[model samples]
Target: MMHHLLFCILLFPLSQLVCAREEAFAIVIPSSRLQCYFVPVESANHSKLIFDYQVIYGGISESEENFGLAASESYSSLTVAAETLRERLIRLRKQLDASEHFQSSRRVYETRDRMLMESKLSRVNFWSFINLVAMITVAGLQIYMVKSLFEDHSRVGQLLRRTF
Candidate 1:
């Protein structure tokens, strides 16, 4: 009797679990050291779009909101890169401001002394600006290259999984 009761309970309305599928997605944005991931409850193959934490983009019907191709192409990626550069620029500007403030105090000195100091300061500032900008540009490019490498790694992983 206990066995029969157990069997009946097991067969009871488990229909809710019958037709669903789960999928995961991951994406590495171009030119930045960032990646996004998503897991869709319904089959990713049935959806036309996907959304991740900070990204949204074109997708295949079977694509879930996972970190797949579409999500990487979203506008969020651009915003991230732009915002990063802006922050760096703001920091550099603050340094420039500090230098300017320091120079302003030298205004009380004689014309000859002030002119000489100003000339030296100006030359240093000009070179500093050039170097800072060049450094930032190179850093940004490196970040982009790293992100691209991440994408390649993920792709290789996927390929390996499928082939194995």
Candidate 2:
């Protein structure tokens, strides 16, 4: 299978894919200068309008011949890189399909829900324990307040009555 894949990759014309001459990119707007360019509506569609700023910086030339040459060079390099990436992905996929890790991945995924629920349950139990403690503490405070209020013989109750 590996030999067959290797043979196909070598024989395939993956490098010969037709790519565009120029790549589209976002224009850089300078904060200092703003200008509007008006081209006749007829020429507005993909007009050879290279900005003066691009020319000043020795950027892409407006010559169609040079553009074609650059495009061909870039396309060849890009296709080679793409083919390498595809080959790597194919190899990795094959490795993964044959490995024990892929076989157990489904089981791992299935257990994730149980693990998450257990985590949530633990959090709920903790909060319940905290609430129980808070309730007990509030009950104790309420008992103390009641005792202080109604027990006439108690010093705390006498103090409270005098303060009130």
Candidate 3:
């Protein structure tokens, strides 16, 4: 019984470690200014845009015959990257399907719950418009105040210098 209990305890952590390693994902974002590459994590499900990706590493530029400037840019590299990511995600999905902890039924339940909540939330009114207007007004007032204060201080400094 003692040996059996020890074996179970050892296997539990090993299983967890293996599971964690199986679901691991790595994304490298290279920047010229920053020497080191960064792995960005998804913060929210609603937000699909990746932030701080200013550098364009791999892409083809199309030249315009009539005009001097480039007409368009090809997204072949980006599309290839997206396809690779999708393939990885699909593999992960298949692994998760086989997992005892993560089953299709649970996913369906969660999806239904999320859809229901979103539907209810969509019916409610938001104060976003009012907030946006208030924010713009405050920013405009702040800029005007700063500009006026700077002008007044410079004029006062000029007068004082002239008097001295």
Point to the candidate with the largest TM-score: 2
Enumerate clash totals for all models, in the order shown: 10, 0, 0
* Cα lDDT tens digits for candidate 3, 64-155: 22434343433675678899999999999888768846676788899999999987776543566667889999999788655655575666
Ranking of all candidate structures by their lDDT, best first = 2, 1, 3
lDDT of 2 at 77: 96
144, model 3: CA deviation in Å? 0.6
The sequence of per-residue lDDT tens digits that candidate 1 reaches over residues 1-164 is 56434332233222111122334333334332333334354756565443322223322232332555465577788889999999999999999999888787665456779789999999999999999999999999788655655575666555655676
lDDT of each: 0.57, 0.61, 0.52
TM-score of each: 0.26, 0.33, 0.20
Q: Model 2 RMSD to the real structure?
A: 19.3
Q: How many backbone overlaps does candidate 3 show? A: 0
Sort by TM-score, best first: 2, 1, 3
Model 3 misplacement above 4 A: 1-125, 153-164
- Lowest lDDT sum, 10 consecutive residues, model 2, at 52-61
lDDT of 3: 0.52
